[model samples]
Target: MLLRAALAALRRVEPVIVLEQLGSTFFDTALQMVVRDRCANATDPGRSREDSQQKAMTDFFMTYNLILRLTPILPSLLLARLSDRGWRRAPVVSSLCGYLLSRLGLLLVVVFSLPLQLMLGAAALFGLSGGYSAFWSGVMTLVALRSSAGDRAKAMMRVELLYGLAGLVGSLVSGHLFQLYTASLGHGTILLIVGTLLNLLCLILAIVLLQVKHVSSEEPEEKSLLPPTSSNATAVEASVSTNLVNIVLLFVAAFLYDFAVGGAIGMLGPFTLKAPLSWSPTQVGYGNAAGCMIFLTSYIGVILFRRCISDEAMILIGMLSFASGIYLMAFATTTYIFYIARILNLFALIPLPTIRSLLSQQVQPSSCGTALTLLQLTLKFAGLAYIPAFTKLYQNTLDWFPGFIFLLSSIFTVLGMIPISILGWRSAGGKCHVRTQGGKQPRCHLEEVPAGTSQTGTET
Candidate 1:
């Protein structure tokens, strides 16, 4: 009975997911405060110029991004490989430890007013702990293991919804929390402390309350060393290779889409903190909360449209929504216009989850961790390229047109949509068909519909 109870308790990792995201989001807002404060302090003494602060913040972010991207590649890859080898919780626990330390480091910074560059060390520590790449890759593997392929889409969407909801709650209260002790000696210290506590709690929960064992699928029968062995084995190898190629395509799509979104949002806070739409901290929190709400709206979109449309179509619609909204944001002169543009992004959250689901379906269970980690690696590398370019572009155009960064983001988003469009065209026109069965002689046929039958008569 005790064993059964333990197993049952271990099955519930959702709470851990929720708390982790909540803590991360809360710290995210606090880090924004840190950036603003540190930038003002780093410039000339008693200088509070917006341009100086902006430049300081940009420089800090660029450095932080570099550290985050460069440090995680090897650790995340190693941790993911370990996870696939049955140490399923290794990456998750290590990554949570990273979060704990990073948050704690930030909290200390807030309490002591340390140098802004210290956060770079913190970021490096976090990356060494496998950071977001390993953590999310582990989480995806867990989700995939627990779900059937047919239901994996909904399962992944459920996690994204939870993540968004936690972020929404965190963002809604973060700004207020940041102000609560500002008049006291602590200033934003209380908020960071709370975030640290939350991180510690999540790390504890992850260590004690979660249990997972990843058992890899049996290896294929050993083939002869010589080339061109059995025809059947050759066909199997070719099929596996093709599936991998398709998954790589999915990752590329995700990389481009994430680049567009990340670049736009990275500059958004600094942009809003400046003239024209000079937003207060509360407004910034609300703006972030609005972005979180996109996940909820996209979840609803998945529910309503997924039944009638394919995942690719849903992704296409989401890409278009982001492209349109971001393009309009280039002309958003007022906060109201900005909010309107955000509203137009209701479908913006669909593409990543849908693309992830599609990718998850293409690979075997054993490769889930590696596949997801590589996908994240792609995103990180994209960030490495896009963050500096976008920051420089925004800074250079700060006087005449800061919104040009959003325009560039919209263009990348459009570029992302093209791959999905090609995928959809291929899928719908019966050019690409993946066999669902196993074994070397798996049955295959051209996916088609009879001339006299309805569109859905034989194919989705």
Candidate 2:
């Protein structure tokens, strides 16, 4: 029974998470080396090696960020719209193709010592296929379509848990993989090959095993996940106006929170390689592994706290935890202190997924693809702005203080808490439960309910 249950769960869950983790682990591990190689190759013969290398790295990153952000916006939007209109597998399969090609591009870069600028072309291809925006939106739609509102938070958390666990394993192994074949196949070719294979597997899985069903937003009364509640049923209903307001607020919060987190992740590798902590590749991999640990710990946190606290409260706590940890990271000059800061960020990933689950509850199932894709758009657009800004900031302060970038990240995280706080306060004050149901504005329920949990009591 346990084996069957596990198999059933795997069949229901999306495999994109594992594939993405494998590719990301390989890409991030190779990115720094690629930049360094490009810089070395570009330096004028007998020139100031340090200055030339630094400039090359900076230029490469700035250009990479710009292309990555700009190229995908339109394609991802188009792909997402088509998915919403019934072409569900297009985005998933196409994005996997992009990942495979991109990894292959990286492999060629390491194998033939191709120009670093070639990756920009690969990035363009990735964007053309819709990249992560379309892929994630599609995956989120799959998750939402498979579960009801009350179970969505759990479902999303489970996906995140799998994603993080895969990331942890990938990160832990990536350094060894890179090192093992560096002498035989150049620096990062082996890792890139592995990533490409992983992407291919995902593409195959999507083509063969994955099946997307269009679940109805309005379930039958007899089959409702929430049991009928005569007295408190109306309390959970929200007016359309109120729902609109809350959703807008949630998106704004998501934008701010992601800006901080994404900016930090984008710049951390180069920053660590320079100045106070000149970490080796192994150390870099370990640092990334530690970051992946956040997912596992955050998953555990959700399980432990969801029963006791509201999702809104959990999001608030997540934002604060990230802010504190990132703030401390700005002062971390040693390896030990850096790891300590990572430990402090155990709950950093909770807010985004929780916010997404909350947003899923506000929309009908048919709109999940559109809604989540728009959310992904907001985040990717935010990344477009933040990555360039953070890279520039890190470059300017590299000599005087490279850690300044982290300080700015910490500030944005603090700002992200505002909307969450407002929502939490409103919920605490008993103004959140009176919601809309079946075209009727019902009376507000006074009972405290978590953001995604049904106020009317759930099925056993």
Candidate 3:
């Protein structure tokens, strides 16, 4: 019984999420440190090395992240289609293959002392294998298929919580591992090797252990908002139109919010290594762990908030939290101020996963993977914008105001909130139920209450 239970449990994707995130976190710190080290060593004495190193770091990431974003679109769409067709493991397995190869490439680079430019090739390979777009879409599709719509947001947030926990654990130990070396091996070589090995394990599990859950064949019951007539055709038509509009708006909001986040995140890699907060490897790991803590806090927020309010309201609260915190981040010169900013942004990760859950609800089960992948692809396009635009903006503003990009982020976050607020209004027509059938989580939806009917509950 114990063996069977353990095997059955292997069908869950939690392990894959944990392992991949852990590996990715390790690779991330190692790559950042390696890039900084390379740029520092290559800087000439003629100019300010600090400025030169910063420029080199920014320029490298700009090109690297651009390739990362743009190359995965076509492949990701293809994989998502395969997933929707019942080959749900396509995206997960292929992306895991990409991850393994990329980590291996980095490992080889570190061991052989290869030029940093070679990493761009690895990034291309990773993208061509579907990258994060396909992977996340695949995971979300699997999780969403197994879950009821009422519990979708909470389910997805649980996956993210697992992801963050893995990242925190990996980041906490990554610094010590990076510092460990032997007579033959150098700094960070051990860390890269471990990261690559973890990816390999994830690839094996994605193929051999992961189970795909198929959703119901019955179509979603988009409740009728209009009163009963001879036929429900008008209600169906109105519902379709409404769904189309909501999907588009959700996409817009997600893009804007991602854009806001990308700006601050893009700069943070180089920002921490700058003047007032020149964090060491351990300190960097701790800082990253601090960021990961938000995932836990956000999940808690979802648990508490998803019960009383609509998902849109939760998203708004999250956006406001980020906007306010990132605005404070504009002047985070000291480490304590940075921690304070991070603290204020505790619910920051809530919006995107909740947005994804909303997107999943807008489409049929068969098209869930494609819809989620498109959302991921849309965010990639957002990343494409920030990679060049914010990188250049930050480079230009480095001397005058290093945190100018953060202010832009805050503004974009505020702009992102508009669509969600609109969504909230559109879905607030009548009373909502706190618990659906089987006592699942609340859904952020509404139906028309006729003139004579009395509504008792509040909008979810």
- Per-model CA lDDT versus the true structure: 0.78, 0.77, 0.85
**TM-score of candidate 2 on Cα atoms, chains taken together:** 0.87
> Which is the better candidate, 1 or 3, if ranked by lDDT?
3
* Candidate 2 residue pairs in clash (backbone atoms < 3 Å): 235-445, 237-434, 237-435, 237-436, 238-435, 238-436
Q: Write the per-residue lDDT of candidate 3 for residues 132-249, one digit (tens) a residue.
A: 9889989998998888766778899999999999999998988888899999999999999889889988888889989976556343333222332326586567656776787888
The count of backbone overlaps in candidate 2 is: 6
Best by TM-score: 3
* lDDT (tens digit, per residue) of candidate 1 on 1-460: 9999866765666777888988887788888877887676455444347777888888788889878888999999999899888888888899999999999888878778787678899999999999988888788788767765545667777888888899899899888887877554476688788888888988888888786634332322121121123367776675456455556567778989999998998888888777788877788789889988998988888888766777787888998999999988889889999999999898898998778777766655667788788888998998998889998898788767879999999999999988877666645554334565666555545532211112343212
Off by over 4 Å in 1: 1-10, 41-48, 182-184, 213-238, 429-460
Better of 1 and 2 by TM-score: 2
TM-score for candidate 3, residues paired by index: 0.92
The clash count for each model shown is 0, 6, 1
Candidate 2 lDDT tens digits, 57-114: 7768878777877787888888878887888877888888888888888888888878
lDDT of model number 2: 0.77
TM-score, one value per model: 0.87, 0.87, 0.92
